[model samples]
Target chain A: MIKDITLGQYFPGKSFVHKLDPRMKIILLTFFIVFIFAARNFVSLGIMAAAVFAVICISGVSPKMYFKSIKAIIFIVLFTACLNLFYGTGDPLWQWRFLKITQSGINTAIFIAVRIIALVLISAVLTYTTSPTDLTDGIERLLKPLSVFHIQVHEIAMMMTIALRFIPTLLEETDKIMSAQKARGADFESGNFITRLKALIPILVPLFVSAFRRAFDLAMAMESRCYHGGEGRTRMRVLKYSKKDYLALGASCLIFAGVIICSIYLPATVRTGM
Target chain B: MKFIEVKNVVFAYDAAEEGEEPKTVLKDISFEIEKGSFVALLGHNGSGKSTLAKMFNGILEPESGDIVVNGLNTKEESTILDVRKSVGLVLQNPDNQLVASIVEEDVAFGPENLGIPPEQIRQRVDSALKSVDMYEFRAHAPHKLSGGQKQRVAIAGIIAMEPECIVLDEPTAMLDPQGRKEVMDTVIKLNREKKITIILITHYMDEAVQADRVIVLDDGRIIRDGAPKKVFSEVEFLKCHSLDVPQATELAYRLSSSGMKIEGTPLNETECISAVIKALS
Candidate 1:
């Protein structure tokens, strides 16, 4: 069941979106998120949704993946939409004991739901197209200014890279430990909550021991490779903006400006009610 | 043309508790590795072979003596990186050694650490992968690879650094038979084709037999050091030191001891077969 997780998974593709520089992609995503929240009337939200759909199509990732991401957060979408349903101040569309649904509430509920879905889909597009190492590298380069404050940006990136590299290894180790424990007649399937928690002790102990051992081995290996912090280190896969990245960045800026303009000037017929 | 020289080196780990004595791992070890030599270090667990391996690349400091790699003293802090650069170390566990998720990226790590330019690192990564015969899997995730493949990638990571010597600490200890053969083949190829000095620490007698020279360590001291034939022929001496000789050598020794007129000891399967045939005829 743990193996089925699609969160933060990268689907390799030859799409232009996948070819865009990761730093540029991250910048474009930031612009997108700002515009998504800044959107006011339905016209602006519609434009934002259309923009997200266009990127998702261009990303070449199956629509099913976006749906999977949305599905993972379905509970949050429903809960927030329901809470917004009764809080808007407008003409009552329905009335019942403690619950009065307004026209504005209906609009707000739909607006929030669509907004949430757009957020989920656009972010999914970023992760789906970019590899994890590229994503971390993009983040590290983007956050380079933080080093002025002694934030250790490179160290953070190094830690992130190592963590990602070890995730699958650790997961495999966990699976092996669980199986080993199971072979020794340790039951993890049937028990009360506390008892189940107690049953995890056997697996956890060995997993921790092995993780520490791996960490030591990795440290020694890193030293042997002359890894003396991030100072004087050069990257093989350096992030550089290409013509396509500039074009994509420009296109994103235009769309964000268009959303803001449409929200201020468009007719208020389908306005977002909150 | 000595690539690495160890002069009476000794190493010990600190005491685990305040009242306990520090445990010595390597005791007054001295050796010289010529350029392009293939030397196998043989010892059982805790016999200081691993400790001696670390000393070659300055990963561990000797408690009393000195180790010089290509004339750079390992004791100096400034030359430590240079020492490591000249002598790449391939560790036993392949899974723990790879730093990058992707195979090529992992191979590029050593070069990147040395601050090589991006283009040079790319070329090195490619060539290193090709040398290990893993170039096709350059973009594949390391975790998904088989044990032998992962070990090759680990070796590629070391090879990309362009080190003159490589010291592997029982690299096949965690691998299966096939994985062991794969790693052994790669190591031998590197030694013969690349002319890189190889110091292989292993307990496997067959692997030791394949080396140009075998140095046997027992209880933190060298017991035998010579060519494989010269070393393994003393089967009784090796057995007395709690080590095993190659199967063929043991059989030949037993046969000769049982009063069969075997002309000489055999160190491998082919030699053993010939020896037996000659004895029977």
Candidate 2:
């Protein structure tokens, strides 16, 4: 049952978007998430939609993946959209006891639904192109400034890297332990909630024990490799930005300017989005 | 000159009882490894070979006396890091020792720890991967490789550090026959072409036969120390220590005892074959 949880969700490709620097991709995503919510009216929302469309097109990923991401977050999107249906103050389109639907409420519900879907799709595109390891590396690079505030950025990054490295190994180990228990007639399926929870104890205890053992072993291995708290340590694959990153940064900055201009100059009454 | 010097070193495990004496694992052990020499330390279980290997790199310090690694004493705090930098130790399990997910990243791990420049680290990782013939898999995950390949990668990790000496403690014990041969070949290539001091600790007599010198440990003491031919020739002594000689060496030992006229004890198949031919002729 645990086998289906895809940890990385990485879709390997060589599209222009995929080839962009990870730090650049992350910075782009951050701007995207903020500007998306900062959008107040139709003009900025259209611009955000155009940006998402451009990323999707340049990414060369099949549209099926974006839909799958939307499917995964469908419940939250529907719940938020339904909640927005009762929110805006405007003419009632449909009336019920303590529940009246306004025309603006219908518009706001659509806007909220589309916003949630776009958020999921944009983040999905990031994960699909960038590997988990590279994603963590990008995060570490972005968080490098946080070290000035006495945060242990490098340590967190190392921990993240090690955790990512061990996931597959531990999953394989869990599969083995589960099979061994199953062979001895330990029923995992066809049980009540409590019974299923009880059956998990057999699996969880051994998994925890082995995980601890692996941790101890990895700690020793790190010491043998002369790992001393990441002080002055260098990496084989250094993260460096290229021309593509610069181009993406410029394009994103221009889009942000457009978004801000549209939000201010464009009147709220021109409410095509909501 | 000696690449490593151990003089009157003693090590003991902590005593469990308040009044009881500590259980000694290594007692008054003294040895020196010549620079660029291939030496095999042979011992059965509980003979302290692994403990001795750890002490060489300052992983475990001796309880008494002093050991010097490339002019740095293992006893000093500041020098211990230098000693480790100079003398790399590859333990038994490759899986446990590999720190990086990628092959080349793991290879560069040791040099990176030493604070080598990024460019130099790149060059070293490339060369080290090539040395182990694992260059093609540099981008592949370390867990995806076989036991032999992983051990080779581990060796490459040690080699990238440019350590003057490498001490492998039963590196082949967990490998299959083919993996064992793979690692042995890599170790031999490193010793011959690179002229790196190699100290291989194992009970495998075939591996010891390939070494320039074999030092046998029994009950935490050196029972025999000499060339492989000289040491394995004492078949009865080795047998008493619960150790076996290489098959050809034992064949010669058995045949001669059965009234076959073998010239001398042969250390390997080639020597044994020629000796038998000479005797028949």
Best by DockQ: 1
Question: Can you list the residue pairs that collide in candidate 2?
Answer: none
Please, what are the lDDT tens digits per residue for candidate 2 over residues B63-99?
9988998888988987666787778888787777776
Q: How many residue pairs clash in each candidate?
A: 0, 0
C-alpha RMSD between model 1 and the true structure = 1.8
TM-score of each: 0.96, 0.92
Predicted candidate 1 versus true structure: per-residue lDDT over B122-219, tens digit per residue = 99999999999999999999988999999999999999999999999999999999999999999999999999999999999999999999999988
Candidate 1: residue pairs that collide: none
**How much does each candidate deviate from the true structure in C-alpha RMSD?**
1.8, 2.8
Cα DockQ of the candidate 2 complex? 0.52
What is candidate 2's fraction of native contacts?
0.45
